[model samples]
Target: MTHAELHADAFATLSAWTPPSHGQFSLREAYLGFLAARPDATARSCAPGHLTASAVVMSADRRSVLLTLHPRVGRWLQLGGHCEDGDSSLAAAAFREATEESGIDGLVMDPAPLDLDVHPITCSLGIPTRHFDVRFLVTAPPGAVAVISDESDDLRFWPVDALPPGTDASVTTLVAAAVARG
Candidate 1:
């Protein structure tokens, strides 16, 4: 899809999603407002912030989650990243990130967003920016093996109840949402 199509998809996904909490509801509204103001909000060069797509990937049995040790964040977090220019939709961008990071083919993604988060960081642009992340739930096939991409310092699966120490709180929230969704 063209860049404009992906932006429209982002707006549609956030608009359709019913937040599980009031905080998320506020975030949803805030994101829609942001998108309304910035047509370039989907681009990595947006400077202020941009829409990123991420996946909380659960094992088929819901016993484990595939996480990445992000080189930048220096923490084990869910697999996801920025929406590419060629992405067809926000959901597809999320699925693409999961597939690329996990190196697992045929990963099943639920099109509806699982959660939303806005966090500040210096992304690839090498300047401080916020990631208005749109999170989704994806299921890796049973016995799926992940090959760590250059994007991560490491990659592996951890039991849902036993994530690594110092994992991001947002990651914990994502795991909870994935479990609840299952």
Candidate 2:
């Protein structure tokens, strides 16, 4: 499927379900609002119980970012997942997701969150529907090889200027902003 199709499908999956446990209450509420406001849009809010965090893992050279092709969502996404109970902070949760999904060890990530975004999911039913996605900026050593995990069907690096066709626009904006700041 095309990238847009993949994104739409993923959003559909999220919208059909309620937020996860790790999601913040305010974010969850906002997500529901989005779903109600834009039913025609392909995204829905994640339920409170299904909230999760993610990280935008970048190579040390700062030329590329690590992304995973999630099997369920079937979209190219940054490395991230649900925040388990033991995570001390959002950044930690993002870190865990990054490592687990990408299998790139020894990564160094900022202690704080880099950006916050909210997107609606369209997949789950009887759920509040949305993910208040919190993303972090993480760096790996130059030339690090990414090992894809079960969560993702593939793992690879894409150039900052020329990303894969299916990447989220928000991700590109964030990456560009970071590059500008540096």
How high is the CA lDDT of each candidate model? 0.93, 0.64
User: Which parts of model 2 are misplaced by more than 4 Å?
Assistant: 1-51, 122-128
Which tens-of-lDDT digit does each residue in 95-160 have in candidate 1? 999998999987998999999999999989999999999999999998898888899999999999
lDDT of 1: 0.93
Give the range where candidate 1 is weakest over 10 consecutive residues by summed lDDT. Answer: 1-10
Measured by TM-score, the strongest candidate is: 1
Lowest lDDT block of 10, candidate 2: 40-49
Give Cα distance to truth, residue 57, candidate 2, Å: 0.6
Q: Per-residue CA lDDT of candidate 2, range 22-68, in tens?
A: 44345545645643454333322324324356888887878888878
